[model samples]
Target: MIDKLAWIRIENGAILTARSHNRDTYYIPGGKREPGESDHEALLREIKEELSVDLILETVHLVGQFEAQAHGKPAGTLVRMRCYAADYHGQLAPAAEIEEMVWLTYADRAKVSAVAQLIFDSIHQAGLLK
Candidate 1:
């Protein structure tokens, strides 16, 4: 199993997603946490490194945790994604290894990672995605 953290940013019925360099599928922003780091710390650091944005510490909240077959990994490999929603400051832009950033709706689910597909379903069911 691969454990990861992700940021959920929905605006106007679309969610923010990123595709890293050399990767074909997009993933929700945020990444794995470093040792001894709290969820907020890791999330803050990852988002800054990946998107060059600062998450408002007080606005961060857990959205949900989801699991699915790991995309591009062994057939049975599972990925557990802990997702959070937060307000941020600064312009969103591709940074670090991210090659592209896009806003995706429910109809575009197939373009993202397996874990992200589950996230889309949850968001859509909650009436957040178009």
Candidate 2:
């Protein structure tokens, strides 16, 4: 299993998604935790690196956890994603390995990873995504 962290930023019923350089599918922002790092530490570090934004520490909140077969991996490989929602400071821009950033709604589900599809399903069910 690949354990990962993801940030959920919703605006106008769409969720923020990122496509890394040379990658075809979009994914929720954030990444794996570094050694000995807490969730907040890793999430803050990742969002800063990937989205060029500072996630307000006090505003971070768990959204949900999700799991699915890993995309572009051998069958049976799974990704376990822990999701969070937070307010941030700074304009959202693609950075680090991220090649592009886009706001995606439920109608754009096919453009993301399996775990991200699950995220779409969840938020859509909650009536947060159009």
Candidate 3:
């Protein structure tokens, strides 16, 4: 199983997502935790690396944890995603391996990764996303 962390940033009723270079599907920003790193530390570092923004640690909160079949992996591989909601400083922009940054809504579900689709469902249901 692959374990990952994601930053859930919602603005104007849309969620922040990113598409890596040469990739077709968009995914929530954040990445795997490094050895000895806590969730918040990893998330902060990953987001800054991917999005070029500093996450406001004081505003961080757990959104949810989701598990699903890992996308594009061999059968039997699973991914456990721990998601968090947090405020950030600085403008959002694509960086590192990211080629594009997008704000996605429910209508754009088909353009995201499976795990992101599930995150959208939960956020939409809670009226946190439109």
> Which whole-number lDDT from 0 to 100 does residue 27 have in model 3?
93
| Model 2 agreement with the true structure over 1-130: per-residue lDDT tens digits | 9999999999999999999999999999999999999999999999999999999999999999999999999999999999999999999899989999999999999999999999999999999999
By lDDT, who's the top model here?
2
Using lDDT as the yardstick, the better of models 2 and 3 is: 2
Writing each residue's lDDT as its tens digit, candidate 3 over 8-120 gives 98999999999999999999999999999999999999999999999999999999998887888988898889999999899888899999999999999989877888899
TM-score per candidate: 0.98, 0.99, 0.97
Name the better of 1 and 2 by lDDT: 2
lDDT of 3: 0.93
> Tens digit of lDDT per residue, candidate 1, span 1-130?
8889999999999999999999899999989989999999999999999999999999999999999999889899999999999999999999999999999999999999888999999999999999
Candidate 2, poorest ten consecutive residues by summed lDDT:
90-99
The runs of at least 3 residues in candidate 2 whose Cα sits more than 4 Å from the true structure, single-residue gaps closed, are none
Most accurate candidate by TM-score: 2
Clash pairs of candidate 2?
Answer: none
RMSD of 2: 0.5
* Candidate 3 C-alpha error for residue 102, in Å: 0.3
Global lDDT of each candidate: 0.95, 0.97, 0.93
- Tally clashing residue pairs in candidate 3: 0
